[model samples]
Target: MFKNLKNDLPASIVVFFVALPLCLGISVASGAEPITGLIAGIVGGIIVGAASGSKIGVSGPAAGLAVIVATAIGNLGYENFLVAVVLAGVFQIILGVFKAGIIGYYFPSSVIKGMLTGIGIVIILKEIPYFFGIDKNPEGDFAFLQVDGENTLTELLKVINALISGNFDYGATIIAVIAMAILLLWGNVLSKKGKFFQLVQGPLVAVVIGIVYYFLTKDSGLELSKDHLVSVPIPDGLSGLKDLLTFPDFSALTNPKIYITAFTIGLVASLETLLCVEATDKLDPNKNVTPTNRELFAQGSGNIVSGLIGGLPVTQVIVRSSANIQSGGKSKASAVIHGFFLLISIVTIPTVLNLIPLSVLAAILFIVGYKLAKPSTFKAMYDSGWMQFVPFITTIVGIVFIDLLWGIGLGLAVGIFIVLYKSFGNSHFLHKEGENVDDGKIKMTLAEEVTFFNKASILKELDQLPENSFLELDVRKTRYLDNDIIEILEDFAFKARERNIDIKLISERGIIENPDSFIEFFKLKKPTE
Candidate 1:
């Protein structure tokens, strides 16, 4: 791991920058302390990464779980919810031990596409408030499309109006803009040519700029509220650790509602982690496959640690994972190292971290979101296949129009429908084998399992069977023949007796005792043969 430090350090720094905003944003979105996100990121990197068997997977506070966490807090109270998170982790570990990791594989590719696209769209929408300095609760909190007199677009319009009409604080706005500018400059402009800029990230730069700007603009008597910037309580001295550990009252665990919250968190967090891990693996340059079982275990441990420490539940996150990969991470070491970095930095330099401007973080996420929702992404999905394109678009629309899980669920449903439609449709094989028009042989083999979809084609082929000539109806490979097709074969078999047609079925799983039902299955009203 040390040997890869040269590569890992740069990747770690990039991941740290990428994770900073998401950690804070997702936590805020979950109605938890912004520090909870940071704490999750730290544990994800340090503990989860170390324990994880996945080579390149990075874990953190997941946006996918933001809604679940938020609702849990609202329903069960924050204190009780913390206990649920710990329990969720325990559940995940049990799942991993059972080798349930392969469940991630069952999620359709289309659904996965939809998930990534949805997340991309959601990131952009949620960050809009931050980009303009409207200063909402947090970016991830936009799960339900907060009830305005109108809708999301209208509320967003109001936020825009506030920004334009000077209803928003200019001090925060100016500093945020400066932070964004600095970060962008360093990322897109300066980092290419310099070592220091590469060593330090644009978000950190924006944060530093925010601090400098804050001090420089303090005398302006701006209406900037503390809520606009980073807001973790900075306790004094080593004694501060006491406040970090938040204990949940487990006495109420017997409540059905608490159990419901625990199950919800466990399931949602697991799904998110699985999805993000898959996406991140795809995004990884090396294309390394992470061990899903160990990923679950790591997440479970991280959540357990986080719950005990007043932090948020954790999951593998694509945003930070992609950043880790693009920044050139070599192994899990970079991820583990970043965890320590987060822990040490927050503890030793809380005042410094608090200086990070929201706008600058927005700028950072703005880049991440762009990479995700890029125009090319749509083109790529469209090029993949109809199944891929459908769910991919649905996911994007769902997240943009409703919520993350809703979009993914809709996409998942569509994807599953496509799969089942194909499976049921492929139950049998269609053949056009009669004395050929050109060479005396035309066989259009149908699938093993035929359905109504193949009926038209099969009927067409059977109609063209040479009259009183050499006709071979081969059903050797077919397993389960649809009733409609079975009837067609039955009629054909009876009609072939009137001609010189020969029927043959070559299937191991096909009907042996009831081979006669092969034709009766279709039961054509008028046997043309």
Candidate 2:
């Protein structure tokens, strides 16, 4: 790890810049203290990073869980919510021990792509209000309907209305525009000029510029207020830091609601973590595969520690992980270093951090959102075919209109429906050369493996066979046949004789003459000479 410090150090700095605002934003969105988000980030970096099998994936408080955390906190109280977080961590550890990580593999590729795209759209929509200096809703809130009795579409209209009525904050708009320009220039031009520019990072520069602009315009009409900047609890000393931490109420263990909340958090956090692992692995240039079970164990440990220290639940987050990858992170050291940065910055420069404008962070998130939901992604999915395109689009629509889990469920449903449709239609092959069924020979070739899904198609084909027709039932290529199909064939043999139809049965074992039952014939295999 030390050998790769040349690359990891710079990557860690970039990831730190990207994660700082997000940690604060997600905490506010989750209805937790900003300090809680910072604590989670620190634990995720130092503890989880040390324990995780992933080389590049970063863990923290995720925006996807903001709604769940907020609702759980409201229902369970903050102390009880911490209890739930601890229990959720225990649950994740159990899942890891049971080797349940394979469940991530069952999700279709199309659905995963759809999920990434959906999240990107949500990020763009949620950040637009912040970009315009409207702070009615918390940063990182991505639900279609908001806690403030407004929806995504209405929020956009509110921004537009503010602009038309001159209710917008020019300070925020100017800072945001400047921040975006700097980020674009650094990424496209300046960063390419030298390692120093890359090490410093565009987002860090944007943040510093935002702070400078805040002080420069303090007495002007374009001054940004405290509400428009990052807010970290400034503690005076070790005693003040001690007061910032909150412990879980062990008394809540008996409450059924606590258990319910714990289950919800565990399920959602595990899913989001698994998805991030998949996405990050794809982003890794070396194509390294992270151990999913180990990741779960690491995340569970981090959440336990975080909750004990008054932090929000932690999960592997794609946003930070992607930043780490894009910034040239070579190992888990980068993640660990970023965590230390979060820790040191909050403790050492809380005053300076509080000066950075929220508009600048919004601009940074806008770039992240665009990269995730690029238009080219949609075209590529469409080019893959309707099977991929349908689920991909459905997931995006569901996420934009509904919620993340609901969107993934809808995409999975569509993917499963497509599979069933294909299975129902392509179960077998029927060939008949002549038009007259009475004279022509009918050949029914069974698929490689016939299941109950093919039962309907098989029955229909059998019923349409002409009386006195010569039918050949072929199962030479079949490896396994469902019991229902075997019964169907057995029952058909008796009925075929009644219709004066001559039927020949073919299989790898050999031909059967007037078999009484397909099951009996298969069970009575001849011994080798």
Candidate 3:
């Protein structure tokens, strides 16, 4: 894991810069103490990262679960919620043991692309307001509709109004612009000039500049307030940090609601983890495929540890994982190191950490967002044809307007419909136009598997047979014919007689002349092996 220390160490710094605000913001959004999110990040990074088979995928408290976490906390109390989170970990471990992680492999590649693209768009949109210091919502809340009563679109509209009225923070906007400029220069030019630039990393530089700017502008008209900065809870010492940690209530074991909440958390967290593993694999430069079951087990163990210490539920989040990959992380060591950073920084230098401006982080995320949702990616998907493009576009729209899971569900539904439509048209093949011209003969070969969905197309073909025609029905290649299709053929046999059609049934069993009933014929002839 430490083999790529040069790469992983720098990348870990970038991920730490990216993850710190997210940890605090998601915790606040989830209605938990800010320290709880940090704990989850620590566990997810150190514990899950060490156990996970994925080299680049990063796990932490997820934005997708904010609503569930908040609701659980409100309904059951924080202590009971911690109990639910612990149970949720147990459930995830059970799922991993049962090999339920394979469920992620079934998602179409187009949908996965859509997921990455959609998240990129969300990150850009959500971070825009932060860049200008219009920070009403938490940084990690990625849902379309935010907890602040405004949707993503509406929030942008608010930002525009704030800009027009000159009601925004000039200090934050100035810092964000400078940070973005530094990132662009460092990434596009400076990083290529020498190894030192790559080793330092643009994000870490931007953050340092932002902190310096914060101190320089203090008490001035352009000064940024606490709302525009990273917020980590400061503790007196090791004992004070320990006092902040809350343990799960074992007394809640008898509560049925706790189990229900646990199930929900487990199911959602596992799904998110699996999806992330798939996406992360796609993002890997080496094209490494993570063992999904191992990822689930790692996530389960992380959640268990997190909950035991009063932390939020954890999932493999795309934002952090993508950031890690974009920052050139090469192994799990990066994730583990970032966890150590979070642990050490909050303990030793939290006040200084809080001095970093949120706008600068927003600037860093803007780059991450652009990388994921590049305009070229859209054109490439469009050129891939509708079978791929439709689902891909639909998922992006669904994610932008709805939530993550709902967007995937909508895309899956569209993809399935397209598959069925294609299947309906491809049920069987007819002989060449000029073949069997004598005797008005027509040959039809059934597909490998004919289901009820193909009944209409088959029926139409049979009804179009000319009077006095010779029909050669071929099932030599068919493996399974649905009862509906068999019934259709049986009904068509009676019509064939009226049309004076001579039917020749062909199968592995034998050929028959004018077979009486398709149902009986199929029953007598077993399907080919």
Q: Choose the strongest candidate by TM-score.
A: 3
Q: Name the TM-score of candidate 3.
A: 0.80
Across residues 265-356, which tens digit of lDDT does each residue of candidate 2 receive?
99899998987787677668766668889999999999899989899999998888888888788999999999999988877888988888
Per-residue lDDT over 296-323 for candidate 1, one digit per residue giving the tens place of the 0 to 100 score: 8888998898887778888887777777
- Per-residue C-alpha lDDT of model 3 across residues 271-362, encoded as one tens digit per residue: 88887887887778765658888888999999999999989999998888999998889999999999999999988998999898889989
Q: Which stretches of candidate 3 lie over 4 Å from their true place?
A: 424-529
Number of backbone-clashing residue pairs for each candidate, in the order shown: 24, 0, 0
User: What is the C-alpha local distance difference test score of each model?
Assistant: 0.70, 0.82, 0.85
Candidate 2 lDDT at 407 equals 88
Model 3 clashing residue pairs (backbone): none
Q: Which runs of model 1 end up more than 4 angstroms from their true locations?
A: 142-152, 163-185, 194-197, 220-225, 425-529
Per-candidate TM vs. native? 0.75, 0.79, 0.80
Using lDDT as the measure, what is the rank order of every candidate, best first?
A: 3, 2, 1
Better of 2 and 3 by TM-score: 3
**Which candidate gets the maximum lDDT versus the true structure?**
3
